[model samples]
Target: MQTPLDTLQHIFGYPSFRGEQEAIIDTLVSGEDALVLMPTGGGKSLCYQIPSLVRPGVGVVISPLIALMQDQVNALNELGVRAGFLNSTLSMEQVRETEQALLNNELDLLYVAPERLLQSRTLDLLDSAPLALFAIDEAHCVAQWGHDFRADYLRLDVLHQRFPQVPRIALTATADVRTREEIVTRLALDEARQFVAGFDRPNIQYRIQQKDNPRRQLLQFLRAEHPNQAGIVYCLSRKKVEQTAEWLCREGFNALPYHAGLPAPLRATHQSRFLREEAVIMVATIAFGMGIDKPDVRFVAHLDLPKSIEAYYQETGRAGRDGEPATALLLYGLEDVVKLRQMMSSSDGAESFKRHEQQRLTAMLGLCEVTSCRRQVLLRYFADTLEEPCGNCDTCLSPPETWDASEPVRKALSCVYRTGQRFGANHLIDVLRGSSAEKILSLGHDRLSTYGIGRDLSAEEWRSIMRQLVAAGYLDVDPEGFGGLRLTEQCRPVLRGDQPVFLRRDIKVPTARPAARRAVEEIPEADMGLWQALRACRKRLADEHGVPPYVIFHDATLRAMLEQKPLEPRQMLAISGVGDSKLERFGADFLDVIREFEYTHS
Candidate 1:
């Protein structure tokens, strides 16, 4: 039997197992169940994939998304492994063939959806087959409290009852303590070995900005910070997705919008374009792109705030998957908070569900508005402690110099009260800035004693102060009204000058430098044209096979071959990202390209 390290080198081409991958795999292969909580991009797939190959019988992988299953199967098959998936996308003939293969003991791994796995026919087949192990991908879905809960997932516990002999391994990229416990209970893996990897993705720099002309801010971020890089911009609604995509296009970006509302073909096309095209920006709602395997995503921008830190972490984890530096930018405002609260209130769950959802939303808001190091707060949410501040986040990068805003906060609160506290942040800002907006005049807010008293501060400065005031518990948004600003009981200390409020002083805006558009590292001069030709060939083959191009040959593999100019299959296998499956599947094709190139160029 090959050790996990040997399997890693022979199959996946990675030199070694990353972090706890070996430990988890050893426990599973030793015929014991395990629950693994690994961060995204932490090589979670390898833990199961390697064991599936090394273990005796066919490995049954229960996954939630059909697209994710397809991607995984295709990638596995590219490495010369016998992998198949049974999902809604497959025809009857395809399903029958896969079933026959499994029964014949000709397949190593089979990816099935939870819904399909629960079916009578499928369960019966699995019972007859010699199952090596049962792997649950995205295991957090089994928990009702998890953000992406599915009814079918709740039925997965039956797998344990039926296949008590087969070792079960559940894996998820995002799960807090509550969700983790729920997963363990729901999956009946109470005694399973628990492996919790650290949540830090040091390559991703986190940033949060108060929303001000979000589109403009996004455009500025793209143009000034990360020009011409693959990225995802998340919006809360489909309309916003479309609008943001259009705005990016108008601004000369190679961008596309993807959401469930669009036609399936269009969404697939857009997703394909993002995968194959270089530097494509995908504007999408949460419905699109989970378990996406694309690497080299340079940034993830959230135009609207995510509902929970879990969602935010998972979404941002999609970026910088290749272990490169990336950015997670969030644009948040008070309206986002109101919208989230409304969503929670309107949800059809029980009171406990509503309360939990509200707490998650509140945590997300706190992450956005917290004055401390953003990374520290985020890691602490995942039960990880950071002894020092991560100097990459916005707060850390540009440390705000705070001043006493106690009088200004009191003044703002008094003005809200004098105006009956019926106005939102914008109107309150207008009152503070003494703007004679039509609404202010109509309400006679201009005559208030606190009105115009904050003239010393700019509109932006006053808005920041107001946000801090709300965040610091001196004020609250009225839930009954249209999110009107109101003074909280905590406002008393500030009102009487008994407390000091330190506000972040706004700095002089610096001249913006044009964002550096880093070119995708080119194949060496000797093999540049040949590498492009190989990539073109790979894409054509991928299209014919109906698989993602990366499954054919990752860009990294091509670059390696170009630099080393590998002459044989064995030599090619030595390249990073080129494993046995790839070598067996596409080695001959790649070798043909290299041979032809050498002959012509010689």
Candidate 2:
């Protein structure tokens, strides 16, 4: 019988288990349940994959992502694992064939969508077959308040009820404290052992800027830092996704737009292109990239603010999954917040849900305006601790200046109050800046005491103060009216002049890309030639296999080949990603490349 570690090294070709993977695998292999909250690129799949290989029968994985299931099975089949998936993408004949494989115990792992898994025919088929253990990928989807909620997931507890003997493991890349609790309760995993690795992705550098000419800023960031690299640019709406993608294409980029409103076939084709091709920028709304397995996505840029930190983390995490240096950039305007809040206010959710969502949005706004380390704030939100400030964020790289806004905040608040606390930021700024607009003159005789009180400051300066005041809890958006500003109870002290208030002053980053600590992997000229050769070979093989290039062999694996320059078959087996199957299948082709390079260079 192969042990879990033996299966890992022999089949998966990983020399060692990462983080708590070995422990999680042990729990599952011993017929116990487990809940895992590991970050992206943290090797969550191996926690269940190894146990399935070591145990009897096929591992039944319940996932909501059809594309993810297909991608994983393709990658697993390459490693000589007998993996199959049952999803809508399959034809009726293919589904029956996959089902037969599971029943015959010919498959080591089987991926099924939550809807398909809940079907009575599928459940009955599973009843007749022996089972290793159930693995629930994206377990957070079971939570009602999760970012990617699936109604079918709410019925997943039936798995525990149906198969009381089979061990189960639930895994997700990102889930906050509330969502974690919800998953546990929803999935009936009360007795399961939980393994939570750190939420930090150190390879990703976080950068957020104010949305000043957002398209221009995005273009500048892309051209300067990640030219011709594979990345995803997220937009707030379908319209913006289309516009941004078209504009990027016009500016000489291979960009594609993806949103739910598009035809399903078109979305699938766009996603397929993004996965298969190089240097493709996917401009998508939140509708895309739930379970994308593309490993070489170099950056994730947000043209507008995300709904909350969890959504932001989940989206940005799509980049740098291969543990290479990547970037997460966000450019947002205050209007984004107002529009989001209004949308939330008008949603059909219950009051409690609205309140919780409001809190999350408040925290997100605070992150956008914070002067301290953005990574630290992000980790704290997820109930993870980073004792020291991470130096890989915008604030850490170029710390923002703080100004004592005691007097200015008081004026901003006074202006809101004097305007009956029912006017929006623009109106308040106009009143504070002493604007003589027709509407202002029409509303009053222009004799009010608070009129023109803030004339000493520029309109932009006054607008910044109002924005900060709303974000800092000194003022709140009035839900009763049309995006008006009202004072909150938390602002009583500052309003009474008892305590001081300080705010971070927004500073524009230089257009020239700084030679800062933002990780940039600079390949030497000598290694570039061999690296290109290895990549070309992989791309050629991937096209033949009808899968993504990363599915064939990750960039890291290719780089290992370049660095080691393996000569013989046995030397190729020493590579990190080379299992028995890959060595027998692809060892010769890669070794041939290495030999040619050595002969030419020597």
Candidate 3:
């Protein structure tokens, strides 16, 4: 019997397990249960995948998305593993064949959608096989309060009830403290050993800019910072998604729109293209990218605010998944917050759910407004602490300036109060800026003592104060009053002049400046042609195999090969991602390419 480490290198090409992966695998291999909380690209699959290979029967992976299941199985097959999936995408004949494989013990791993696994026929088929273990991917879907709840996921606990002796491992890439507790309780994993990996993605640089002509800003960021890199630009709605994608295409970028409203076939086509093509930007809403396995996304840009820290973390995790340097940029403003709060208030969810949503939104706003490290604030939400500030985020890279906002805040709050506290920020800003807008004159507010009290501050500056005040809990948005500003109890001290107020001055990042090019992009001009040749070879092989190009060889692996300039088969084995299977399969082809390049150069 091979040890887990041996199986890892021989099959997966990775020389060593990452973080707690070995420990988690050991627990499951010993016929014990486990719960794994790992960030995206943290090797969560290895925790259960290696154990199934060493165990007696096939490993069953319960995935929530049909596309996710198919992608996983395709990647596994490339590793020389006999893997198959049962999902709605399969025909009746294909489903029957997969069921037969399950009973015959012919497969090392089987991927199943939650809905398909809940079928009585499938459960009965599994009863006849010697079970290895059950792996639940995206376990957060079982939590009703989570952002991506699936009713079918609730039925997953039946797997434990049916196969009492089979070990189970539940895994998720995103889960806050509350969602973690809920998954353990709802999935009946009380006894499973828990593993929580650090939520930090050091390779990703975070940047947030206050929205000003958002379309122009996004275009500038793309043209200057990301030129031809593959990325995902997330929008707040389907309409925005369509408009943004079209706009990007018009600007000569290979951009596509993806949302739930699109036809299923079209969405699938766009997703497939994104996975297979290089430098394709996917403009989409939150409905896409739940469990995408694409490894080389160069960036993730948000045109609007995300609903919560968890959602933001998960979405941004998609970038730099290959462990290469990537960027996460966000553009937000006062309207984003107001629109989000208004949507939350009008949701038909239970009152408790609405309250939780509001709290999450508040936390998100706090992240956008924080003067300190954005990474620290994000991790703290997940109950993880980073002792030092990360130099990767916007704040660490270009720290914001703070101003003594006491006098300005007092004026804003006083204006809110004097205006009956039922008016919105725009109205208050107009009043404070002494705007002679007809409404102010119509409301007879020109005669009020607080009118034009903040004339010394510019309109933009006052707007910043109001935004930060709301984020700092000094003021609250009245959902029922069309986003009116009202004071919270937390603001009493500042309002009564018992304490001073300090706020981070919004630092405007000039989008027109050229983004610093990545180090990899500085590849020697001589080697550039060879690099493209190697990629073309990989693409051809991938097309022949009917799989994503990464399945043949990840771009990182190709770069390593290119830089190392391996001339012999033995040299190929020494590459980082070259395991026994891959070296045997493509070593000769890659060596041929490298040998030709060397001969020509010499």
Q: Could you report the Cα RMSD, in angstroms, for every candidate shown? A: 2.9, 1.4, 1.7
**Residue pairs in steric clash, candidate 3?**
none
For residues 462-530, what per-residue lDDT tens digits would candidate 2 score against the true structure?
Answer: 767777887788888877687898889988999899989998887665797544464655668999999
Give one digit per residue, the lDDT tens place, for model 3 in 544-580.
Answer: 8778899888888998988899988777887878888
- The whole-model C-alpha lDDT of candidate 1 against the native structure comes to 0.83
Model 2 residue 129 CA deviation in Å: 0.8
Which pairs in model 2 have colliding backbones? Answer: none
- What does candidate 2 score on TM? 0.98
Models 1 onward score TM values of 0.92, 0.98, 0.97
* Model with the higher TM-score, candidate 1 or 3: 3
| Better candidate number, 1 or 2, judged by lDDT | 2
lDDT of 1 by residue, 322-424 (tens): 7767888888877887677767777789999988886787688778777678889998998987899887777776766778777887888888888897788
- Candidate 1 deviation (Cα RMSD): 2.9
Error of 1 at 206 (Å): 1.5
